[model samples]
Target: MRVALFTTCLADTLYPNTLRATVRLLERLGCEVAFPEEQTCCGQMHYNTGYREHARSLARRHNEVFHGYQAVIAPSGSCVGMVSELYPGLAGTPAPTYELTEFLVDVLEVTDVGAYFPHRVTYHPTCHSLRMLGVGTRPHQLLAAVRGLDLIPLPESESCCGFGGTFALKNADTSTAMLADKMRQVLGTGAEVVSAGDNSCLMHIGGGLSRLHSGVRPVHLAEILASTEEDPWLPETR
Candidate 1:
């Protein structure tokens, strides 16, 4: 299948390896993945911040850039949810967009993509993926099949990590409080790494973990899913 990788702005700017891992994972699954250099922000930051016209303009650009692909796949659930859920309410019609796990599990119908990562990994379901997109169980289902990987249940898995994009910046106090609770729970689980679909959320959680010097780090779900025994991804470096 022909697919376009919609590497979100955060991934492109901060986590390039996550995007690379996504491409590698799709190629491993026999998908012809293409990266449209024209693709930019999905206008999520503008939209969520009440800049309707600005968001609409970027949304139009997003539609144009991802126009012809059979499937436009994104590593971020927030960006995909922004395109899939919010774009329709904007001006132009958006191309059908799928979050990476959804495209892998629902469209490709494959969970075990030959991934191998030996670590006590816990998944944090981002708000857009869990609440907005309703991508329940697909992520866990994929992680369950990874060889030598110990997937643990995150306590109160549905609770938000308080990284609501602009929400974090606007309400710093509330955001930090919510992050404190999330960090406590993450530490309680004794997980070596916390995995989530959205880098925005991971960035928030990861920063807090770093402050505490907890050694627990945040990893994108794509990075973990792309790993294999032969060419293993060292979680410490990732």
Candidate 2:
């Protein structure tokens, strides 16, 4: 199948490897992936911040940029949620979009993508992916099928990491408190890595973990699923 990669703004700017891994994973599964260069922010910030007109403009742009693809996949669930859930009202018709895990399990119909990651990893279901996209257990199913990955269950896996885009900035104290709780649970899992579908949430959690000097690494689900013995994903310096 031919797919268009919707590299969300956070992944494009801060987590390029996640996008690369997503492409690699899809290709390994016999998909032809294309990156539409004209794609930009999904205007989720504007929409969530009460700028409906600006959000609608970008929504129309998104429809135009990714018009002809068979499937549109993004690494971040937050952005996908914006497009799939809100675009219908903002733009006339919404593009067919799926989060990475959603596309992998539902569209591809394969849990074992021939990956191998021999580390204790826990998954955090971001608010958008969980509530908005309802990608329950798909990520877990994929991680379980990996060759050597030890998928640890995160305590309170569904709790928000306190990075609801502008929510972190506007409610700094509440966000930090929630993040502290999240970090504590992640640390309690004794997992070397904490994985999630959204880099924005990872960035928020990773920032707190870094400040605490905790060694728990925040990895994207695509990066983990993209790993194989032939070309193992080496952790970048945090």
Candidate 3:
């Protein structure tokens, strides 16, 4: 099947390798993936920020660029949720977008991943995964199936990482406060690596840990699942 890669704005700007790993992993699995140059922002910012008219134009742009693909896959659960859930609420149409993990598990339907990573790992279920998409254990269902993973449980796994895009700006104080609790949980776990479906949240939480010189690292869900013991890049902070 032909897949279009929606790297999402944050991933393109900060976590470029995450998408690279995603593309590489897909190719390894014998799937064709394309990056649509005409694709830009998914218009989630404008809509979330209350600029409905502009958001509509941007959404129209996204659909126009992505319409031909048999399937569209994005690296961020937040972006996927915005496109799948919010886009319909706003535009009254179907886009058939999938979060990377959701796509891997739901559409691809293979758990072994033909990949491996020998690391102590923990997953932070992003808000879109928990509430918007109600993905439940579908992500976990995939992660646990990796060949050599030592998955650890995150305390209060449902809590937010405090990076709700503009929410971080509109309520910086509250955002940091919430993030503090998440960091506390991550450290409390003693896991070597933390992973999530959303890079924006990872950036917010990972930035805090970096400032404190914490050894724990943050990674995207795709990068973790993409790792094969033979070709491991295990999402360490770079």
Candidate 4:
């Protein structure tokens, strides 16, 4: 498939490796991936923060940038949800959009992309991916198929990670409370690393973990899925 990558703003700016890993994983799976350089934020932040007009404007741009692709894929569940579920109402029609994991498991129909990560990793399902996109169990299925991965069940795996884009800024106290509880659950799993499809959530949870000086680190799902025995992310490096 000729896939156009919509590397979300967060991944592009703060987590470039996740974007790179998504590209690498798709390429390894025999996909002809193209980077739509004109693609920018999916206007999720604007839409969620009562800036409908701005978001609609961005939605138009999003449609234009990814106009002719067979599929528009992104590593962010929230961004994908905004495009696939919400964009049509804002703009006229959106390009066919798929979250990276969803495209991998559903479109490509492959769980084991030859990934090997020998570490205890627990997955946190972001709200948009789980509730909005309905990407249920696909991520776990893929994680289970990894060669040396130890996929542990995260406590309250389906709960929100408190990174609802502008929701955090609007309700900082509530957001912090939710994040605190999430950090507790992540640490409870005793996993060396926590992985999720959305970097925004990881960034929020990871900030709390960092402040607490916890040993566990946050990793993007694509980075873990992209890992191979020949090019493994060593435990010590994290």
**What is the Cα-based lDDT of residue 190 in candidate 3?**
90
lDDT of each: 0.91, 0.93, 0.84, 0.89
Stretches off by above 4 angstroms in model 4 are 234-238
Give the count of colliding residue pairs in each prediction.
Answer: 0, 0, 1, 0
Candidate 4: pairs in clash: none
Q: Which stretches of candidate 3 lie above 4 Å from their native place?
A: 92-94, 234-238
Task: Please write out the lDDT profile of model 4 over residues 59-92, one tens digit for every residue.
Answer: 9999999898899899999889999998889997
lDDT of 3 by residue, 1-238 (tens): 8899998999898899899889988888778998889998888888888899888887788888888788898888788887888777666664578877777778888766776777888999999878988778877887898877889999998988888999999999999999999999999999888889888999999999888788888988788878887788744445
- TM-score: which candidate is best? 2
For residues 1-238, could you state the per-residue lDDT of candidate 1 as single tens digits? Answer: 9899998999999899899999999999999999888877888888877888999999989998989889999899999999998888896668779999999999999989999999999999999999999999999999999998999899998999998999998999999999999999999999999999999999999999999999998999999999998888865454
Candidate 2 lDDT, tens digit per residue, 17-66? 99999999999999999988999999999998899999999999999999
Could you tell me the lDDT of residue 199 within candidate 2?
Answer: 93
TM-score of each: 0.97, 0.98, 0.95, 0.96
Q: How close is candidate 4 to the true structure, as a TM-score?
A: 0.96
- Model 1 segments beyond 4 Å from truth? 235-238
What lDDT, from 0 to 1, does candidate 4 have? 0.89
| Cα RMSDs, all models | 1.2, 0.8, 1.5, 1.6
